[model samples]
Each structure stands twice: as structure tokens, then as C-alpha cells.
Target chain A: MKFHYPNGKPYVPKANSVAPQLKKYKNQVYSNRGMTLEEDLNETNSYYLERKIAIIHKKPTPVQIVNVDYPKRSAAVIKEAYFKQASTTDYNGIYKGKYIDFEAKETKFSTSFPLKNFHLHQIQHMEDILKHHGICFVILRFSKLEEVYLLEAKHLLAFWARMEEGGRKSITKEEIEELGHHIPLGLQPRIDYIKVIDYLYNLS
Target chain B: MKFHYPNGKPYVPKANSVAPQLKKYKNQVYSNRGMTLEEDLNETNSYYLERKIAIIHKKPTPVQIVNVDYPKRSAAVIKEAYFKQASTTDYNGIYKGKYIDFEAKETKFSTSFPLKNFHLHQIQHMEDILKHHGICFVILRFSKLEEVYLLEAKHLLAFWARMEEGGRKSITKEEIEELGHHIPLGLQPRIDYIKVIDYLYNLS
Candidate 1:
């Protein structure tokens, strides 16, 4: 009779029937799961983990826990805590015997990625990781274009420093096209970033 | 008037006065601010971080937040949450261009270190990391003796497999001493674990 979303939006089955435009409907159903770039990346990481391909994970959201109540022996209820800005990038782990760390953030603005998307400390942390010869990068997602790019940390650092030097507050889309590696869309692993890593590493 | 502890016990400052046994008190003060092995390691990691010697950080305790409230424009308060057993090790970081992941645990028993200190998933996580050609280990601390040792994951895996086969559930102190590297005590960076790492890596 009727198909509905959790939000109670009624679905029209006829429009999505198997026909000439089935490919369009198939693509819609494929990406039907509206996941943010971070969630999709996490799923990609899990795919990597399941096959023993990589051991990367998004660090748990940081919180400053202050008080707790032990209601039972098994459960301790936290009473007071505040979210804390992470001192480093959001995700980090081992990939092909190398340390891989990166931050994933999406921008609705298609023309340029804003500098405000990253914090100063996070940029500093990337610098620190680079000093230790670790791999660092940022995943920039332009939702309008459905494009994701792996932006090298060194390039990001250069652009970030330019902001402090009174340059542009954001990097234009054209600049990102030139400086970053585009991540191909996939089915099992939504964003296969390690392929980009191999490409970037071999280049250096 | 007499110096006293907050517990109302009078402090014996005279016994710690300059004498042949003063060195004992000095050592006590040096290591005896009463920090657990985990805290000492964290401080040591910080010392390394400050000097740009290495970048290591203890992951924050993970919590599952079920309810939160926004009473003000800028503040979000967490009302209910519970601690979750971490899926991986207690620490993971990049050191010397390599991924270092390890768990640190302390036991009061002088004879053996209990296998119960680690969860099955953590052991599996280590195996996964090792498969990726990353370094993984366990730092065992004998709190009573103030002794710490770094045990490689391969050695730990062997003992874990032995236990699954109905072998001893714990590893004896002697076995750990033989297989692991003893962390030397120091005035600064109290637990010099990187030294143990240098020793272990050179062996391989």
C-alpha cells in the first residue's frame, strides 16, 4: 500500500518503478542513506577494518567529564560534563605501516572552503604530526558538487598561513582542484582515500 | 603546632631531615608524589611532546551520552552518560615515523600479571594492528615494586593463546622480565619507555 520515511514523508512508488530512468532511481537509493561526509568516511574506515585493510578510527568526541553518580555497580551515571575541542585532528590510525591522521569537514559553499572549518590548534597538531614524519591531510567535501578531495596538510598549512598574512579567507574551488586529489565515489567503501594516499606518497 | 596530613595524622618532618637515609626520602619525593604508572607515562609523553621529541597522547576516557540539554546559547549540558569500554588500546600515536599502539595496565600481584587486564577485543585489535605492520605492545606495571616493563604484542599474543589452550591464566614476573624490556627510572620523563622501545626495535 504505502511506503514512508521515518519522518513520515510518503513515498511515490510509481515514480521509482523499474523503467527507463531506473538507473537514476538506483543511484538515488544507493546514496538514499543521507550520511554526512564524516559518517561516510567512518563507514569507509569500518570497511577497511573488517577486511584487515587498515586500522583507522575517528577519535571519540572529546568531553570534559566533571561529576558522576554510581547508581549501581555496573553503571556509573555522569552528572556533569562539557564538550571539549579536540587538540588534534578527528581521525587517526595505522595504514600500510604508516601513521595516517586527517580531519573531515564538509562545506555547503561550493565556491571556496572556508578557513573557519579548521581550528588553529588542529592546524598546529597537523604541523606536529608532520614534524614526526607522519601522514596528515584534510578531507574537503563539496556537497553541491558531490565531490570529495584529499587536501594535503602542507598545502592547507600554506593556505592557512596566508590567511594570517591578510590573504584570502578561503581557498577557491579552482585552487582545491589543482592542489588536492579527488576521491572517487564507490559502493562498499564510499570514499577510497588510501588510493589517494598511494598516489600522493609515490609522487614524493 | 605540628605539620600534619589532611587525614589528621601528624607529619614526622624530623625523620626526613638530612641523614644517610635522606636519599631514600629524596627518591620518595621524586617518584612518590603518588602517581600511578599510567599518570607517569602520560607526563612522560607530555615531556616528549613539549620538546618535540615525540608525539604521544593518552586518549580521553570514552563516554556514551544519552541525553543533553542546551540551557544557554553557548553551553550544552550533558545530563546522562555512561563510560564505555574502549574498543582498542589505551594509547596510540606516531613515534619515529611509525605507528605505536599499546595498552598500559598495573597489577599489585608481585608474582604474575593477570590476563584479565586486557579485553579480548583489545587483543584482537593489536593483532589487527600488527598485521598492518605497525608496532604494538603492553606496558605492565608492578605498582608495589614500582617496576614497569614493555611487553611486545607478539609475546603477549603467545601468552594469550596459551591461556586459551588451558595454560596459565597469568604470566609470571620472571617471564615478563625475560621477554620484556625494563623501563629505567629517571629524574625527568620518569618512565623512560622510549629507551625500552629503542632496545626492543634494535633487537628486531
Candidate 2:
């Protein structure tokens, strides 16, 4: 389905074709796909910040640093560390007098998104946010197909419930297309999510 | 003047000191007397987060990366970087349906706290938050005297205005003790700033 902005400009992912090289150092793998979903969201956030539209930020993943090396006077090097489970979503902030929280993920699958992509803790966190009347959702990007969907936590919860009942473990792309709102990319704010948010808030 | 909790526990700076070896690795030139005011505030924030009292965090200072080394499948190593100016305060979060923002600073001097410790951008950020009706303040810790003060943005702005007009650029410990509320240290939450917030909210 074609997504159009009120300004008559068709939405396109900014720098979608330019793949940035991933950097790795000392047995660590970092995903570098031109511009990461995180980077795009960050750029969009900066755009919002400059216009005073909202105050949102990506939360750093909590890490338990086990070892460090002091080679010089200025820098601290983490010699050994393990990924610690994050207690909350990656992004949160305030907009229009309401609290906003979300996680962004990208998949290469064209048919459906895998349920394994999200952790149990993240799902629980979303559930808690929903209970508090805060805006919560997942920004899913099918990178291979270059499609993005803003799936509300309500829909996610339904799927999660089915999974708990030993039903289908993942929501199919067809299901997403039917249930989720397509978030079109834009120039100023690459991921124009406020419109999706407006829709969700009114629906709720 | 010594600050004591109502429970008869003395406020001690070295209660949660980071290890000296870790400090050495981090190239922390500041005194290892205890967890710096920032560390204590971070711990206090963790306490609040665990109990779901608030969701405050210190924003890492933005850094401009000049060089990075990628070796094998490991985390990317930042070879060279420069600190970029921050446009906001170090700490911000939501508390009791209101936005909370503040900066934590400590002083060794017994009588006065230096104004030079705060940057102009931070002052502007506080002003912006105040304009937006957010609760903003500074967490001032007199380490040598082992006292903490929760001074409102209005008070700091008053001092800043005087400083602009060729007045003393620092707030004396005596003045802070007179105008600011002393935050009592608690076992569960350590620096109990919520109590101070309640006082400020009631006053306003």
C-alpha cells in the first residue's frame, strides 16, 4: 500500500540504499547497515528536539563491565563485558503532555517477523507501560522489503496471548499489513510516527 | 554544619565509594573520597527505578568521534574522540506526573560552592525547563561538610542574575543551608530527593 503525506510527498526512507559498513573490534560484532534503525530514529529525534516538538531519547543498554584497562590518562577501555538484560524499552520520552515509549527492530524476513526477535522482559515492560496509559508500540522494519510498520502494543499483546495459549508464535506480515499502520519515511522527520501516535491515541 | 537524618544516621560521603583501581582505569582525577556526587545520584536513581518511584537517568555527554578501530568480530573501539557541548542538564526524568530535571555537583570548599562548575548551556537548559513548567533544580553536595541541598531553579536563577550584574559568582554554603532544603540520606533510596520534591510542590 502506498503511504502519502498531506504535503503530497510520497514517503521514502532517507538514505535507504546507502549501506554503511559495520565496524568490529576485539571479538565484538556490530551491525552496520548503512544507517541503522537506531541512527535514523536518533536523527529523527534530533529533528524533533530542534523544533521543540518533543523530548525523546534512546536509552543505552545497561552493561555490566567486568574488566577495564587504563592505558593512558584520558581513556577508559572495557576489557571484558557481558550484555545485561535491559529492564525497559530502548526509546522513551514525552510528547503532547503524554509519556511515549517504544522499541525499534528490523528484520530481513519478507513473509513474517519472527517472535524470537523480542525478549520476554521487553514484552512485559510494554504491558506495564500500557497499564499506565502511556503510548507504547514497536517500530518494525522489514529491511529486505524496506517496509516499516507501527504495531500497537494492543495487537502485540493479542499475539503474545495466543503464543501463551500455544498458538502461532509470530504475527505474519499479512496480519501486520491488516492490523498495523504503515509509517512512511519523510524528509524532516524520517520516521513520521506522530501521525501514527495520533491515530492510536484517538483509537484508544 | 553537619547534616543528619531524622533516624540519627550521619550523612557520609564515603559510604558508596567506587574502587580506587576502577577509578584509576577511568582516569578519574577527582578525589576518591566516595562516589562522586554524580555516582551517588546515579545510585539513587537506580533505587527509584527499582521501586518504580521515578525514571531518571543521566544523559551521557555527547562525544564527536574522530577515529575508530575495527578489528575482528568485536565491539568497535573508539580510538579518538572529543567531547561535544551538551544542550541539556545531565539528569532528567518523570516524577509524580511532572518532568524532573537537575544537575548534581559537589564541592570540597567548606564555605562556598563555585558557580564555575555549571556551564552556560546547562543554565539555559534550566531556564528552558522552568519556562515549560518543569520541576528543575540543582543537587548541591558539600562533600567536606557531608551535606546535600536541593536548591530550586528559581534560587539558582536569582544568584545567576546577580552574577551577571557583577555580584559574587558562587552561592555560599550558609546561604544554601538557609534557602535550600537538606536531603536526608536513607538506606533504601540513599539521597531521598522525593521528600524535597514534595516540599517544593506543596510550597508552589
Candidate 3:
């Protein structure tokens, strides 16, 4: 697949096989398949920001940057840095006077979306957002089926709590279809998330 | 000054110069300034984000990452990158039901703050923000004096217009004191910008 960088130049990954590379990391072994989900969402975010429809941004995983090298003075190259676990969702912004916060995940499973894709901190963050009356949801993409669903945080939290009581560790495709709304891809606005947001807010 | 990294480790910069090294290419000199005013604002932003007061961040100077090295698993290092001009202001976010946008700058000059600290694109961004009813301003820090001022964008534009009419290339200290509000440093928040913001919003 041909892709362009933010500078309009062609973009190609240094590691040809990102899945295998990600699997080598002990912590990310199970979370390896959906690399493209992040890239696609990033592109979609740029689309939203450029049109001024919203100002959402993917917060960079907080990194403890140490030992930066100033080679001749261009940009400082971070020689050593360690990723720090983020305390909030992957994406957050303001849309139409409401705070919007969400995380995007993709899974290969055809029948169910596994609960392991989310972390405890993210769940707590969503609960906090809910308390503040902010709009929060997760965008789950079934890569094999090429379908995306906007699942509200309320539904997610209910399922999450049920898991502790021996409920299903995953939400079935049927459940997602019933509880969530599908987001269609378009030319101008690639992901069309705001449409889902509008529906969720107005309907609720 | 002693500081702890996000990982709870001590942060120690290389023993070169505390001042940021400058890289000059062609005719333009890019000063790293160890931590530029941009970096200070980023720290202040993190402080705000962590405390749940506001969410503001510096838009990474859009970079064209041409080559990245996947050295160790899960780590992507940019081997070659080039800076691309940004289309918007450095900082923006929502606070207390209002959109906030601003640029930060530091001037070494003791008497006057030079107009060259700002770019045309930034001025245009502030204009756009003002047009959309967003709260926009410039954060100016006089380093030698250890003082910071929040100058409204309207006042900035007024001076910028006069620049083309062969006016002074910078705003005098007296003008800043008269036209802008001084930001008092605090213990917990450090930079109490939102207080100044509240004053700005309520005054109007």
C-alpha cells in the first residue's frame, strides 16, 4: 500500500513486518495485530483537525526522555527514552461544545471483541469522563470483517464489571451489532466519527 | 534544578552547556535553547493535564520522518527527519466551556520584546481563533526579569499592523505592562494561566 507522510512524501515502515517486531516485546504480544488501526485513526484525526470539525489529538504515550544528543543543532535526537503508561484514553478533544474522549482498537476475531484490548487506567479514565458529563466511547474495528463500531463507554463499563462476576470475557459480534452504531467511511471525512458522535449525543 | 523523570528517576542532561545549542543552516539559526519557551509551555500543559484543570499541548512542529529505525522491538526511532511549518498556533485546548489558543515566546532584550518573536502564520492563526470567538493570546516571558505577561491577541494585532507602517519593531516594556496582565507564579500550579484567562474572559 502506498502512503504519504505529513510532508507529502512517500512513507514506508522501517520494519517490513511490524507484527513480528511487536510480538518480540513481552508486553505487546497480544496487542500486535492492530498496528494499522492506530495509523488509520491518526490519518482520520488529521482529517478532523484540518477541516476544523474537531481538535482531537492522540496523546503521545508519555515518555521519559533521557540523554538527548545535539548533533550539530538541527533537532535534538532523543538518545534514550522509555515509554510511560498513559493515564487517559488514546484520543480526546472538544466537538460542538462537548468534550469527546475515546480509544480505538481493532481485532481479528470474527465472533467477539476481547476485553484485554483495554487497560484498567483507561476504564477508570472513562468513568471519570462519565462523571464529568463528557462524551466517551471506543471505536472497535473488526479487521477481518472491515466493520467499525462506536461503543459507548457506559456499555463498555457494564461489560467490564460483569467480567469480574464470570461473565463473557469478550463481547460477541452480535452484541456489538445490537449495542453500537456502525461508522461509514467517506471521501472527505474518512472515518465519519462525528456523525456517530452526533447520533449518540442526540439519541441519548 | 533537580527534576524527576516520569519513571521516578532523576533527569540529568549531558554536561555540555545548560543553554541550548544553535544550529545554523543557510542563513537561519535555529536555537535549541535547552528548553525553549515551547518546552516550558509543554511542561505547564502537562501540569494542567495531570491536575484535570485543562488539556493543552504543543502541536509537534509537523515533521517529515523520512526514515525510522526499529532497533529494539516496539521502539521506532527516526533516523532522518525534517521540520515542516505548522498551520496553527503552538497551544490550544478547551477550558471552562471556552476554547483557548496561544503562542509562547521569550525575549532576552531587557527593554523591548521584539516583533520577530512571532511569525506571520501565528498572527494569522490568532486572527482565525479570534474570528471563531476562541480566547487567543500570546504568553511572553522576559527571561532576565523573570516575568511573564499574557498579551491579548487583539493588542498584538494592533501592534503588528503598525509594524508595516514603519513603527517600532518591538513592543516596549511600558506598553506590555499597560496592555497586558502579569501572570503571578504560584506554588501548586506554578503558572496560573487559567486565572489570567478567567480575568480576560470576565473582563470582556
Per-candidate clashes, comma-separated: 0, 7, 1
Per-residue lDDT over B1-204 for candidate 3, one digit per residue giving the tens place of the 0 to 100 score: 133332345545333222222222211223444244554565677677667777665554444333435666676554444444554666766565566778888888889998888766667657656765678899898877878899999999888767755677799999999999998765556567888887767832
Question: Whose TM-score is greatest here?
Answer: 1
lDDT of 1 by residue, B1-204 (tens): 122333345444222122333334334433543236766787788778878877877777787776666686677877767787787897888888989898999888999998888877688789889998888999898888888899999999888877776678899999999998888777689887877776767732
Residue A51 Cα positional deviation in candidate 1, in Å, after optimal superposition: 1.1
Per-prediction CA RMSD (Å): 14.3, 11.2, 9.2
For A16-130, candidate 3 gives per-residue lDDT tens digits of 2224323344224335466666666777777776576676667554543333456785775555444445656877666665667899999899999998888666776677667
Q: Hey, what RMSD does candidate 1 come out at?
A: 14.3
Off by over 4 Å in 3: A1-39, A42-52, A59-64, A73-79, A82-84, A130-133, A163-169, A202-204, B1-52, B55-93, B115-133, B157-169
lDDT of 2 by residue, B1-204 (tens): 233322346544334344555566345434454346777787888787667777676765454344455668976555544444565677776666567778888888889988877766677667656765678899998897788899998888777766665678799888899989998766767798988898778732
lDDT of each: 0.78, 0.70, 0.68
- Give DockQ for candidates 1 onward, in order: 0.25, 0.09, 0.10
Native contacts recovered by model 2: 0.01
By descending TM-score, how would the candidates be arranged?
1, 2, 3
Candidate 3 local distance difference test against the native: 0.68
Candidate 2 — which residues are off by over 4 angstroms?
A1-31, A60-86, A131-133, A154-169, A202-204, B1-29, B33-36, B59-87, B161-167, B202-204
Worst 10 residues of 3 chain A by lDDT: A13-22
